[model samples]
Target chain A: MEENNENMTFENSSLAENTAVTAAAVENTENLNAAVENAPDTNAAMENSSAGSPAETDEEQKKPYRKIPKGLLWRCWFIFCFFQRTCQCFDRAYCNAFTYGIMPILRYLYKGREDEDEQIHAGLMRTRNYYLCEQSFSTVVFAIIIGMEEQKANGADISDELIMATKTSIMGPLSGLGDAIHGSTFRQIAIALTIPYCLEGSIVGALLMLIGMNITPWLTTLIGFPQGYKLGSEFVLKLLQSGKMQKAASAAGLMSMFIMGGMAAKYANITLSLTFKNDYKEIKIQDMLDNAIPGLLTIGAVFGFYGLIQKKVSTNKLILGTMAIGIALSACHAMGY
Target chain B: MSSTGITLLVAFILACYYGFYSTYPFMILMGPAGMGSIIGLIIGLIMGDPVKGIEVGALIQTMYMGVVGYGGVLPVDQFFACIIAIPLAISSGMSNESALALAAGFGALGVMIDTLWKTINTSVWTPYIDRACEKNQYRKIAKGAGLYPILTRMAISVPIITVLLFLGSTAVNWLMDNLPEWLQVGFNNMGTILPAMGFAMFVSYIGKKELIPFFIIGFYVMKFASLPIIGMAIFGAFIAWLVAKTDKSSDTEGGLA
Candidate 1:
């Protein structure tokens, strides 16, 4: 039985491969009118080629992508992209159950053989189990990859267990890498670029931020889907070992630091408004400070805040502390002391 | 509708958005609807004073730029903060500084409400999905997972926002009318100091000992050369590229050796 199934798989794959080639050929034919004219001939040829194949029934059953309508797939993408975080209740199973639970929609749409329900359930369970680990930025990528794997599996040869194992193994490294690249590195750079414009009340700045922030996740998910499908479990290791990801992140980090410094000087406002009476002259403290180092107070303020943060001061405490000092200084100023 | 009624209505809508009513995972990429700058712009448009709204929003935005909620932990509730602070600032003619100080306090309050809401959602709403899964009902499961949470979030957000907007405007007006001048000045002063605190928090998140020099360079170029932020960013990118190249070459040599 196993040998028969294997032979059937091989024949079906070869037939599908041929169809894909013909589809490509039809696409590559230049003129629009010529392509249109050739479409019926190509279809006839494809039907003739598949007609002699003994595994035609299997081929019909295996065309899961065709069975799974575009609208259903779109709905799957919508749920995977947006609502995967709905149930954060289970500790190890974070998004796993939610991701697994939604796969039935796609499976039902794929409309495999009547007896294939168990295979579908097993595939869904494996997907659910592998996605047990929690992730933020990479969750969408993981979902897309799993969806592609299910669609491609076609209920034979590629066991649910193998597919599940592939997904489970890659989750850890992908999560860590994604958090570093998307969460820490790219996000900071986006914030630095957008904040200045936001401060200026420029709609352009907000728009820029909206686009910059959304595009990364969107593009990553888009690129990750195909790469994950092609590479399977090897995708995570290839991505991490490539060293390019780290290099990009570090470069972004350095740029972010420079931008942060610029922001500090631009936004961290502190002025020494006090003027001192010196021998035969009135010296403005702020003027002297500016002469010695322009944006002197601004630099000091950033350093001071940095120092406080290094001391592990909580954000709320720092906020309250800053407020107290400001109020005290204002009171002093008001009293003319 | 009265301007206060209009403002509250807008605030309610924003609260629903922030409540993660629909496809919030995608919406989050828009950078948190509750962010001060965005909120300010929205409020500005609603109040018919986009310029002042942006100014106030910018000030508040600086305070929270370094703040991020990861692993279900939010240090402050900027959503609630902006809702209460912006309208009050606009109505009372409050300086940016005072508005910021008020936002910090209100944001902390928002954190509590957010905690309460999330607790209810996880404990109550999440189990419905598990039930649906056991029954093998795909449509039920999808609705339980997707649509149910949105409904719950709306339930939690709408009323709270309405009350805050209605009462907040009255309260801010009262404070403005009754408060002594010194206290008002104190709030104003606190605002100026708060931005430095914001920057400090930001530095802590992205600061590296090796990158300290870049920060210094950025400060000096901005102060001494009086370069705009865009110019500083360009220079920063150039330096980063040079550093990255050198680091790559050295690593390759090290690997070969």
Candidate 2:
């Protein structure tokens, strides 16, 4: 097990159970050592093998294993794809993480520490898969969480197809989320206003962003983590105290929607164009639309077709329809419409 | 558009990188937080996981992000709704009102649906995910390469953008003519009500019970301090951070007052 640990950067817990496995050392984040602090993270392998709970049950539920039958993936890929296709207006996470992060977390939580090399490998692979494919931020967390869980469980052999299916399923929704959060809102709010100040070369904006976006999120996550931990610890107690999961989902949903609605009103813009009608003649319709309507219209179009393409409308047809609209609009602009 | 304008526009577009071109179909099918495509992607990258993190991250993000139009101010866009998840929804198509509705209704649904799906998956598939928990490096590689959804979207977006580019101006007129009444009213109402809602949510979510001090701090910065928008926001965040760092017990109280 120690030999395997040396060969792999992945976190597997069989070393503790085996006892022969070398304990990978944790960077004593708490140890106040300034000199000779080059201690290796080697003991972590051994310590983790024994203290392996982090590998498992650190988070919530996950997607079904490939080996499992009659689950959501096979039974309802199409249904699930509704959110996958339309995760543009808002940033999504729980479901994607469930399939990716939750999977391994569960695996690790339920099973005893053993060789879970296959599962961890699969989870990480799926995580990277969607980053390029769709560009979501949740994908990595989903995979690691799943990997951690799977490592916790002794780890049973799961098939490639199921894991792949989970990986592929999450790619697009996650990417869209990635674009909206860091790409649009975070980037825009964090830096859009700050860039001018920073561009004029003020370190103020840069520092402001550091605190606004980076520090804010980090702080939120720090607080959130413990809240989540407390929730996890009292899972059964909370369940009994709170009654069914449905009520909680309902409250959370209403709260989430209320928040989402507020965002659309404030940030999603697509106002009319401003231009002179000469060499720069009147602004092109595209410019006109962008300036006049803001981008909310674009969001509308995506949502309008979400139900259609997600189920009945084919991908081919959707693209075809979009092109037809784009061309027609482009032509109108060209022809002075 | 001038070449310069187009260049600038392109840079902006790249920076924002709307996720619809890549993830719509699968999201619509999957019903994760439909709005969380971008966040899911970021969470994925941050976690070194990608889409899977998106699956889970979307749920988490829905709490922090959203869409509100008119006079309302939102912390983020609410693209989680189903209508917005469709291809080209937020691209060059649809009306402002429609987009707002799509984002609002569908984004809300996305959160609900994602929660629903997870609840079911948890109940049904726990044993399965449990089995395959150990494999790591390999899974990450596979997760990175996975592109079925993108391929699927590309297959669709290409035609849509191409066709729309040449379809003519009548489409725009038709779209304008067809604007719905409920939507108009909703947008108007939103303009009036949303600001209150957004600020209130910030107070509620951030405040929980600590509203007075946060509001006082926010008010001080907004009024007396009169810092720039970004500065004021940072000050608010700083205050929030200190408050956040407060012991859970302290945080729960309304305030010293």
Models 1 onward score TM values of 0.78, 0.33
lDDT of 1 by residue, A1-337 (tens): 2353344344444443343443343232233223223323322333333342465566655462333444654566556656655444333334533454346554664455664565445444444442433234354445434544443443323444444444544455555556556655677777677878777778777666667766666676667755553333334433544556666777887888788778877787677556668689987777787778777777777778889889887777877777677667666663112
Q: Scoring each candidate complex against the real one, what DockQ results?
A: 0.38, 0.07
Q: Which ten contiguous residues of candidate 1 chain B have the minimum total lDDT? A: B21-30
**For each candidate, C-alpha RMSD in Å?**
10.1, 18.1
Residue B102 of model 1, lDDT score: 88
TM-score for candidate 1, please give it: 0.78
With a 3 Å backbone cut-off (N, CA, C), the pairs that clash in candidate 1 are B97-B191
Candidate 1 lDDT, B34-54, residue by residue in tens: 356766777777777766777
Once model 2 is optimally superposed onto the true structure by TM-score, how far is the C-alpha of residue B212 displaced, in angstroms?
5.2
The Cα local distance difference test for each model comes to 0.61, 0.33
Q: For residues B27-96, what per-residue lDDT tens digits would candidate 2 score against the true structure?
A: 2111122224333343234334343333332322322322322111122334333223222222333443
